[model samples]
Target chain A: MMDPQRLKYTREHEWVGLESPGVALIGITDYAQDQLGDVVYLALPEPGGRVVRLQKFGEVESVKSVSDLFSPVNGEVLAVNQALRDHPELVNQDPLGEGWLLRVRLANATELNTLMSKAEYERFLHREGG
Target chain B: MPELLRTSLYDAHKKLGAKMVDFHGWEMPLHYPAGILAEHRAVRNACGLFDVSHMGRIALRGQGAAALLDLLFTGEIDDLPLGKARYGFLCNEKGGIIDDVVVLSLAPQAFLLVCNAASWDRALGWVQQWSPRFEPVEIVPGREETAMIALQGPAAAERLETLAPGLSTSLPPFAVTSEVVAGLLVTVARTGYTGEDGFEFILGAKEGPDLWRALLKEGAAPCGLGARDTLRLEAGFRLHGQDMDEDTTPLEAALGRFVRMEKVFVGVEALREQKRAGLSRRLVGFTLEGHDIPRAGYAVRAEGQEIGRVTSGTFSPTLQRGIGLAYAPPRHAEPGTRIIVDIRGRDAPGKVVALPFYRRKQGESSLASL
Candidate 1:
């Protein structure tokens, strides 16, 4: 089981944490990273690209399959983890911290209320069973 | 309804925590807890065992069996000596591949044909259809009575030598012998899907679990369909359904060498016609320039025009590069030709290359000195 204390999560298994008021850090959950092993490449959206809730923002490639990254909240991309461009394994190594995929500015502050809390995310993880 | 087809070693696979998936209508294990990369590495560096009982096994025994088999398959089956095996294809009336199979000449008048499980019904029906004109023929319904296991990698021989004791050392590539491994009656064949010097053992269903445990105890890593796919792809071997289907002819798939027109077969005329007309599309191997992994059904583009689609693709663990096979236009099928694969709405550059990205060293007794 992964600790959900440090971040907020989406039902679709993405994690988002507020770096600042409007700026938020995002990456996949530990479960998601484990499901997609040994990430080889990551294609992130442009820094200024607009992202909407439940929409595809980028893609991650592993050895045998490729998975699409979905945005959890309506936001505009402020920055992306360029380190992932070469060493995508970072996502597998530290999904909660250094492996953060992108930073975005949330368009609406109310979006935070709908996000799942640590306890809620744990329940969700249990329900989904990874 | 989703029907689950279980192999002889289903309980053993479940005990090992294998991720099960539906493959060719069989509930086969995709990988174990260690995962595909680990299993592949184990098979490459050490020893690994696989349950391939899902494959079809048929027997042809009669006075005129050899003559009848020569008329059915594309390869020279009659020429195969007793106890030797040969790879061949079963083609349809229209010259398209029905199944790619292996024929083992167990005796002068008896042969064992191993085919893909999914095509068992069709192959059986085809043989039954031709049986009246030939001689007595028998088709085994399922491998349920038999349990198949593969011991692969560089150290596979040594491990087998220790486990079975003298049952694997004298074996040469493609050689077959019925020997007792772990006190179980098993037919050990020195042939495998991975491009490694290994052996594939066919044993009884009741003895499968005990044998699997004994093999694991002897350091044979448990592999699954995932590693099997990567290994076979790297070796440039074709999966029956993906590489060549009912619509795809053997000639178009670059398997012309396996088809011998010197003898009569079911689809000889159509294949001859296809050869005369020239191939429109051909199967080719390619590697993505970057880390983008092309998948099955991804389109292949040449100069902005859709030429073909990838049939099978995966990141080769041994090569450390994304590799795939596709049916592309004949013009772009040549080695060193460049093409772009549309990977999730983005174009990734790929180049055609010679197949079997890897090959194992020949055995000591092989025709070529190693």
Candidate 2:
């Protein structure tokens, strides 16, 4: 888990970290990575592609099953983790730091307020009976 | 859902941090904390042990035992050499496979059978349906005393050699022998589903946990059904329910070599007739065009029209690619034929290839891949 005060999350379990003035770094939370054991492939959106809030942006395929990745807030894709194309295990090894999936420039910064904080996301997972 | 049945190793699996899942109404370990990919590598590169107690084990011993097995199974069980094992199928009268079984000739007029856990009940019912004709044959459907375990990989023989010296030298590959392992009398068979050379052991359930622990201490990695499925798939082994059902014949399933028309057995006539008439569709192995994974129930397309469906598929840990098995027309079954896998509305291009995406090299620990 990262520092509680700086990170924001979505109901779908993605985490967003403010990297610069309007840029954000995003990746799935630790809970998501554990639920999906052994990530194998990722079909990520291309750079400069516009993404809408709470909409499907890409897919993450594991050995067990495939899951849809939802954008936590509206943004334009700046970059994807190219290393993940060959080494998806990084997601399971470090979901918060090196395993970051995307670099997106924020479309609406207020959308971050709509997301859950670190403490709230933990409570949500607890309430889901996981 | 009804409560799932637990094996005797339920506690041991929990202690090892196994991810439990339902397999044919029984709770079994799908994978341990190491995950499926790592476990698969362990079996390919070294020794891996698996608890297969959920599989059905049936024994028959009497004057009528050979006669009983001869009429029910499709292979020549009576003439199966002593201390040898034969792979064959139990089929319905229409040549539909009921179960693929391993027949072990224990003694004169005595034999043992191991079958898939999913099809055991049906196999037992088939046995009961015919055993009455072969009177005086004792059938043991629930052999509560024996626990089954599979020790697979190249280093498998070395691990067992530590338990019983001269054990590997005495028995040939695909052969069986009885030896006391760690003070427990056990039957060890040089047979496994993985492409690697390995052994499957049958021992008393009471002492199973102790032996499991002993092997773990001997550096054998504990594996689960997740790796087992991938290993079998990589080796081009057919799954009972997934690959073939009562509606699919042996020839259509590409298991023609296992069928013996010279001998008398159930469904021999249909198989012979089909052999003469030729097959309508055949089981074929293939690899995906890219990293895309193909799953069961996905439509197989050729010439832009649906032809068949994928039976079993997975990301090959050994080959590092997507591979699958399907039934398609014989023309499309040939190698180098173009095909498409309709994966969730997106047509992923692929081609028909040979079975066994992976093979073990001679005297090598690693797998030889395409």
TM-score of chain A of each: 0.92, 0.95
- Residue-level error in angstroms, candidate 2, position B2: 1.7
The residue-by-residue lDDT of candidate 1 on A1-130, one tens digit each, is 1345757788777988887788888899888877776677788889999899989888888766888888988999999998887677788788887788989999986787788988898888888864
Candidate 1 chain A, run of 10 with poorest lDDT: A1-10
Model 2 lDDT at residue B154: 85
Candidate 1 lDDT over residue span B1-370, tens digit each: 5787787689889999987888888999888877788898998788888988888888788876777788789989766877667777889889888888888777678887888888877887787778776655554454778777888888888887667888776777777777888888887778778878788777777887778888888889999988998998888888988878989888888888888876789999999999889999989999988767889999988878999999999888887778899998788888898889998788999889987676665543111111
lDDT of 2 by residue, B261-313 (tens): 88888899999898899899999998997878888899999998888999998
- How accurate locally, in lDDT, is each candidate? 0.82, 0.86
* Leading candidate by TM-score: 2
The candidate that achieves the highest DockQ relative to the unseen native structure: 2
Off by over 4 Å in 2: A1-5, B363-370
| TM-score, structure 1 vs. true | 0.91
Error of 1 at A58 (Å): 1.0
Q: What is the lDDT of residue B260 in candidate 1?
A: 88
